[model samples]
Target: MSTMQPILRSLPRLPAPNLWQSKFKGSRARGHLRVSVMTEDAADAAVKDMQISDHPQRSIIEIFPGPGQLTRSMVMAGAKKVITVESGETFQESLKALEQNSEGRIQHFAMNPLSDPFDEILLPEHTAIPGLKPQSWDKVHEDVMIVGSIPNSATGERVLHELLTASIQRMGVFRMGRVEMYMFCYKDAVQRLIAAPGMPPRNRVTLLAEAAAEITPLVRPGAAHFHLPYDYQLLRLVPHEKPKIETSVDVMDFCLRSLFTNKSHALNKVIKYERAHAIGSEFLGHPLLGPGAEILLGRLSFDHNIKVKHMTLDQLNEVALKFEQWPLRPTVLYDDMIMYESRRKR
Candidate 1:
């Protein structure tokens, strides 16, 4: 896995294609442009900033390594093993060249990284891929790193959401270790990650990312590292060493989504609407509701109009802790508790 030259220097020069030039149906469409690192220097600098050199044993899983600029950089950086999932066959020749040069150190799969589940790709048993090790659910390893850039589109959002969901659920590749993500995404997405309590645009994604992991910004928007017109961001995400709140991923998702439906609604109104109904009543009775659960029933005189967006991470964690105390878990049901309130008012 060691390379004498810097990773980029080791890579043979390849044509960097623009989105319009791509033959992939999805890529040729408007507003689905892929932002690629056009130069080896940029790629090398990005990897260097990640500081992966100290961990020579660390492996990488790259998504959509279009044109192989960063792919070459990672390989040159001496990644123990590089596994890539690329759906489009357009870059086959260059990617194949990389695979051959790496001497089996790089494994390329011609599958859509978004549609394919990580379990089948990362686990040996789940996948028939030989020579791979089986990862256990209870075990943890931090050697695996996920690195790549996603397109700036709705599809890209879904792809990122899927990756985060996998991490939160600790399934597949995530189960193999404490997976780390080094990603290039829209600046707005980065804002969502680091948004503080009472910040504008705070919503479900913000809560889920903060609850599941610690997000750190590697590069801010408008950085000189990128050659694109729109601002892009580089970020790193790793699960919390010791989670502040112990709860299932489902509860977090259901509770947060239900509460944040109307982000501007006061917390008191939100809670009352949710708990006053049949479903809320049943949820309150659950053992996880805990002895002190009744305390939440009384609305605080201060901040009676406090919205979900106004709550800090600590406050959100506190809410999660209280809800987890409930004994019986309720299935997530989508209902307009607000509409019910409106009907009652009428």
Candidate 2:
């Protein structure tokens, strides 16, 4: 696949971008929201920034995709298929609209995602993807899966499971441009239900590790999480003994710093993560150095966190071991303006 104009624009923007500027580079930065932050614009920029491999032979595959300004931009850029799953016919339609109005081709299919036979919708050209009996979209650009508090709301479960199934295989193969899995998010319940479908412990660990690999393989959140109003959380497929937040930096910094001495003074890593993400193949030999360090890295590294607190301690240990080289970080920080928003809301 030759570099298309769409591809050019999709590439991640350069370092230290000015948030207020028109070329706002990142998708989810520290801001005033309480959920994941990837405007259609940010998402679009991500796809473009993650240009299809220069190899021209390695294809791209996208999972649990949604429609909006950014997704539309992806289809236009020449991604063969952005296999997204949605249960609601209406949501599917809304997502398809981006493709419909786009200069690109899009295929939207209505799979209950939970049990709906995927075969009904998946076709060579359309975007509805079925179980991984692979032929290839061959041109997959990036893997995009975000598990966060804001959720798809309407049909998240169906969409999440299906996308996860599709994306897990690519966990290492394709670098995650953005994945938002976390503990507090409602998705945690969904994850807990699925972790041991009689699945192997090692397999689960592999998935968790791979998820870490996929999400941050390319993109990294900044020194600060998104602003105050924006919501974000860290998740694990299994549980662990770590600090977490229902809201804000004060409590967050307190807990983590108490656990790790320098955690408080350390500059937010969100910016570094984002910049490193653009560079690709993330390996923090000693990414973190503290009790909270592993937890922080795992949460921020890939932009995805799985909820494991509800799981058994045994399960937690199985997955928690990775905190040593945890992929996430305490990189995200709330913006000053977002602080004002919180006060205003009160």
Candidate 3:
């Protein structure tokens, strides 16, 4: 429904860039990289759905915008400023063309988003999210958007995790505000983001994502969507207005890692096999869970035989709250790799 949508649809398709034309000459040869081109209509629809046009002063930090396909749509849709973080030089010509056309409205960063400190290179001075300040965790702002199609790998997942954690912690790429991320990732990555308590493939990421943000499916791949070898989805993640648990992220992180060792096993059954030796060490060092796993388990007030997959979000929050009240804090170093070995044995 945007004015740009019609204009973009009528423009003639340009020839694929040299990197994509040759396909085998550059990063395409690296095998890990993939560039999924979509029609201008598709890009326009995606930008419109994100509501970027609603904000006249919107700023976007896009990751891995190979050759600026979506970037063009964003600029056309009226984003106030656009900054793309891309490392590969293969798309330099096309992106430079976009920059030249924007007349200073668009900028490009020739750096890896995963390794670079965003404040140092990615975000320009005026682009910082309003009302953001150092060491201010509770401060809230809503002017910035992070949009990208991340690579489908552990490294890509790690980068997203780091970005979300930094946002929650009010550091790194998140200094501008609690960012809203719209990411296109493989179906498996999507599963990890939306995984529930007792679902298959549930693990650390499930709790980490749930505790930090509300993940919603924006688009599901279908015949009309962008073509790719594997099905993928666009997910929207916004920080939770009120997190289910009000404990240290580290505490909940340690607790979830310790308890989900045998995720399918009943909570009572797995607790016995967890590294009790590490309970006094630094590994299971959560303030509440570190000292009193049994106590928190009792507070759950559920059948000890319940599998973690079956537990609801409220039940998980109950566990966290119970840990906060424990008077005697203990330290632990439970072997975090218990679940990995369990999966291998299965």
lDDT of each: 0.63, 0.34, 0.63
TM-score of each: 0.74, 0.34, 0.75
C-alpha RMSD (angstroms) for model 2: 17.7
Backbone collisions counted per model: 11, 66, 7
Better model by TM-score, 1 or 3? Answer: 3
Q: How many residue-pair clashes does candidate 2 contain?
A: 66
lDDT of 2 by residue, 1-346 (tens): 3343343334322223234223222233332112323354444445544553332322223333332333354554555445444443324555665545433434444454445333344443444332223323333323322322234343434344444443343332222222333222232433333344233232232233333223222233332332212233333221111212132323232232222222112223321222111223332322222324544443443322332222332333332343323444333333432443354358
Taking every candidate in turn, the Cα RMSD to the unseen true structure, in Å, is 6.8, 17.7, 6.3
**Candidate 1: RMSD to truth:** 6.8
Ranking by TM-score: 3, 1, 2
Candidate 2: worst-modelled 10 consecutive residues by lDDT: 270-279
Among all candidates shown, the one with the greatest TM-score? 3
lDDT of 3 by residue, 1-346 (tens): 2132222222223344333445323332333544443456667767877887786565688887766778888877777667878776766777777877775557887778788447775334644334434333353344567888777666667777776666556566665556678887777888877876667877767777887787888765442444333465778888765555567666566657656654666665454444432333223222214434565566567776788677665666566556556665444423434544465458
